[model samples]
Target: MFWFVDGEKSEYSGGRTAVEIKSWCTEMTGPAVKEISSRKLAEEQAGTKPICVYEGPEASTDFEEIAARKRTEFTFYHVAVDTEKPTVSVQHKSEEPVACDDLTFDGLKKCLDDNTLPLFGVLDGETYEKYMTSGKGLVWACLEMESSDDLEKVADEYRPLIKEVAEEFKDQFAFLYIDTIQFKRFLEGVLGVTELPTLAVNKKAGDKLKYLYTGEMTAPKVDEFLKNVLDGSIEPTLKSEPVPSSQDEPIHVVVGSTLVEDVFQPDKDVLFEVYAPWCGHCKRLAPEYEKVAKKVAEAGLDDMVVLSKMDGTANDSPVESISWEGFPSLFYVKAGETEPIKYDGPREAEGMWEWIEEHHSNSEGLKERVAAGKAVHEEEDSEADKGEEL
Candidate 1:
């Protein structure tokens, strides 16, 4: 049963004030508890709250029974309240109990909200958002949902397989079934699921990689697929645009297919930008970015340094560490380094040039190339000085 204690009151009834306790539960706490319960069970739309509030001396035995059941079996959320010690604890079936910070109404609500979801469930828009950001990998079974009967048949076929895998790998992944009709756009556009009754896994919080199962749908096959995904045996499917035929602009155009080839060259330091065409900020930065590119070219540093931009909306970076929260996000990658350092300074051309110069001077590859007489920047500067002297 859900627990909600009024923060204003200091003490709880211990069989002496049963009448007062019942009145408080019915009138004051009823509405708020019902609201929290309803929101949590919105997927079922079960209006009634499945809670039984107990008070006084006999409650101790009930709490013990609930705790024992939680350790031995798979059950829903069970909350234990110690009014005298004035502590709150929440526990789900067979899982460790978490102590709530306070006895306030909001505290109880948060505890239940965080632990109420089952290990295996249907994926709706709301639950999908929750699970994707939960820092866990997701395993999805795409089922045809054109008709109620079809949905039921497909669900029945895949439910056992999903449940089995969920039990075995609950720590690593969240198992869910999604309606093909409901998430058609996502399936086709992101995961490239053309057929129904397909299995897919997204390593969202880890490598941000995705994999699809190709063979028959069975518990063992699905288990093997998940194992391979964890062990990195399978290649990930990437969302990439076609590589451009030519890059003649000062800012070399980068696509996902050519990310490693162009930006991650071991002998060249790179200033990379991820921008969306529709973004006003990106549009505003275009001229200044071109100016920076031109400065690099004129200085004869084009071979040692590259100015590149990628349309973040159309392509995904093959480098898993590369990501952007907004358009026109900039990063600097030194030669022979895969890690990208974020550029968060000013947006003007002069400021960008300063940042580039600072990193370039510190580049080990540039030093090595200059020592080997492969880089001409030093020679260009010396010749310019001589010309000035003459």
Candidate 2:
């Protein structure tokens, strides 16, 4: 690394070779830095930019890590590059096998760089910087080994397994990963991963991580586990990001104090179960509500019912929503209207769903499964036809 010297300065034979930049921390480099900076006082020691600043002791458990961060001794190695852009690659140092999908160190940086718009690495760097600074949506996964050697050996063995499992689940919707930091996250998140090869599924929920499962790692096992989760065979102990409220669209969680201002009126008949958490009948209809939330989705009420829970408390009356004078407020709100056709019934999830079938006689969802104009209640129709014959 030759110094940038003036051409007019003919007496100077040439510039100096690679100067080492040094920084001193108040915790570590007191005497050594003082000795080095004192040498810079001489004219021969000119044109050296040693960014020496005192960094106070950080809240760290590992001294080696602290030292590693502070002791960045860069040697000017020769490499031809058109641009002065810094490159990044993610390394997963894990014991348990890592999943390829979870192996995002490289891809993440690439995505950021591409989207950063002419600021290849800088925008990406900004994203990471924002994460580190604000501590927003940050995920930190760590593991402790007997030594660094032990960690390396674990990584060697676990990476392939991760790759295979990730491949198996790639077609599916779930994001499965078991790499270095991610693997460690699985262990810690699943509450002390006891097994040698542990796989943890964590879905990001609002402001917190919802741990799906932490157990033995296998492609088939994970496949079954993921299926069960989707089919509702396994009721997720921790509330996940509320799996796909609408097909092929991102989920939108109902935050507190949000009124459904954007009214989506259904062109066809729509069924909706207005539920409140406090209603005693609503408690009875909890499982029923789950069924309703599902039925509405299945019915493809993407814009229909709008899946809203308006707080009907006297103090906070949301959007002039009519209270279920009955137990389970089963109401069918016609599209483009402030009112819904009240399907008064036992305020329950099932009852709310069933009410639509009984009243409308027009199964909006059933039409898709059946023929275009097939009968909504063929069973009742047959009975009525038999009565006429009798």
Candidate 3:
């Protein structure tokens, strides 16, 4: 006789009666089984869907092949179990099938969670967040999805080419098509896509560096663009204001095109400030930063040092080591060093001067200038004292 609990086989006792078996089950499971049954009943009453699994015999090769072929079309996973080799593997659409290292229930759940996203699909709000956090680079085809017949024709011409490239690089990157009208702001503001049928790639790690494709939309051209992005041969696209015609203020103005020349000078120590025009913190720090710049100029340190500022909202820094999460970010780049040092001290002029003095590489000319300035100050103080005595 078999004892069943909650539709699952529990135990077998050949000599026990029904009453004895019921008593034995209650004694063994105690309150745990009752609690589980209550929860299951509540879920069923609440219309919660249960997880479904499909099983086929080990000898069913036809079923396995069909499942493998249709895996990308459906939401369910196709797991192939090899009875002879005793291995479990999941099929992928464009890449080789991945073998599961862990066969436990939790391990299989983790594997499914990791590989659930489609190889290529339309990019939407929900899928954007998922793909960006998946640690994979994304290739976006920005097309006019709901526009006129002419625009629709343009999209139709490019969609197939994008899909072909996606299939070829499926294992390296996740490809997606975006609705240009729906994501117009993002395209213009972030990716710098002013025209329709634009293609871009975002390497989501670290700084989320992005590159734009400007070539004709063909399968081979798109493939070459993606290859250039992966191999680091293409320069990342960045938002930038036009370079200033003249920068004559105490604080030098910097833009994306002039970043390497102005703020990253190898022969001079540079203090750079990145600020947004609307930020209250940047507004408050403005006067103090101006004071610091004037002081640097007055002290005859302009030759050895440079003070510069950039509108962070309107421009992007090309320096690989420079990035900020907040406005009014300050960085100190020493002479001959590309790595920047963040300033975390007080925002006042004197505090900034102290920080700069401590960080700047002192040369003989700088030392002589400091000494001469000190001597002139001492002479002026002595002359004032003599006037008081008279």
Candidate 4:
């Protein structure tokens, strides 16, 4: 991955006046960026001078060799051109205090600590100061749905006007952005979010977001959606579905609520997972579930997917419904129907990703709804936070 920073780090020694890019290579790769044909290509591509750092593999055990009366064979310097190195010190990055609209883990925690009024769009960090102190205000989350297109695709095809729309809302609200991967999960079935950019606002655990913002998010469009949802003018899109697509959908199992309506919701989705936690397959899906959650959070699409978890293992938390046929089963959902998607074995990231790509949601697979739900269940059911639902 490429990371852009104006400042230098310990690994980089170039002076601040010139732009520089650094690379590293493990023993297996010889040296960082060494495989490249030209350092100039890397420099040109990075818009900065390029440098590589390598740590030679050391396999010679001189002490043991001497004791055994054997020559101390060495594997040092197998591939090397430079021996010179520089030592530099860089100040560790300091974290700033969380702001009300920061959208960071720390910020979420601080808002929970400091707020006397209602707070919304809360992320990972949280506190109990308000509920204990005032007892009336609630923290709400206003999330944007994950889209199925990449940044550029969204730019070129799906929502060409998002950048401008974002610029307008930059000041009015904290506009967390997401890429195509997240959008794919969001667009899978009808979530009433037929439009490209969708928003969800929630105040409680069981409640689906009432306030929404969808379509080309121009200032006026955003205002209209928000005004309607927040003012109770626009009823939340409960049975709303995204525009139908040619793609296959995820296993749209519904839990808690009747499968009366179709869009895959979190509580409903996890029910598929929780129902058969002991299935050797569900256990295998743990890490993949994590990948989905981490990606959604990193992409700033956590709000849109509403990825929550339930542990079928726990007595208190079991998959509310038993789709035994759906257990170890995969499917795509739409409208009010559920279609079984094939799964090779236990639910895993690659397996699920492949299923999602071919079947429901975006082929890009940015939002791992199943995985996210698994993680949510794990975190919530852990001994410490068992009573609290995130």
Q: Which stretches of candidate 1 lie over 4 Å from their true place?
A: 1-115, 125-130, 133-135, 147-154, 187-195, 204-207, 361-390
RMSD, each candidate, Å? 10.2, 19.5, 12.1, 24.0
| 10 Cα displacement, candidate 3 (Å) | 31
Clashing pairs in 3: none
lDDT scores of the candidates, listed in order: 0.64, 0.36, 0.65, 0.34
lDDT tens per residue, model 1, 135-176: 678877787677644654677666666767777887788777
Candidate 1 TM-score to native: 0.65
After superposition, which runs of candidate 3 have C-alpha atoms over 4 Å from their true positions?
1-114, 145-159, 205-208, 363-368, 380-390
Ranking by TM-score: 3, 1, 2, 4
What digit string (tens of lDDT, one per residue) describes model 4 on residues 1-390? 222223311122233342332223222123212333332332333211112112223212332222122111111111222434311111101111122343233442343334222212122212233232332212122233344333433334323243344334322333222342444444332123444446543323223333445455455775566545446676444442232343232222233333323335432322134345557765566567666545545545433442333332221211212233333443333212344322343366556544443543432343465466678868767955755554
Candidate with the larger TM-score of 2 and 3: 3
Name the candidate that leads on TM-score: 3
lDDT of 3 by residue, 1-390 (tens): 444444543224222688877775554443221112222232332111111122222313333333332222222222233344434444433333445565545555555445545544556654555566667777777775555334435545665666678778866787766777766887786677877667778765334357887678788888888888888888898878998888789999999778878877878999999999999999999999999899878888888988999998778777677888889899988888878889787899989887777677775556677778989989999999999999
TM-score of each: 0.65, 0.25, 0.69, 0.25
True-structure lDDT of candidate 2 = 0.36
How far residue 118's Cα lies from its native spot in candidate 4, in Å, is 25
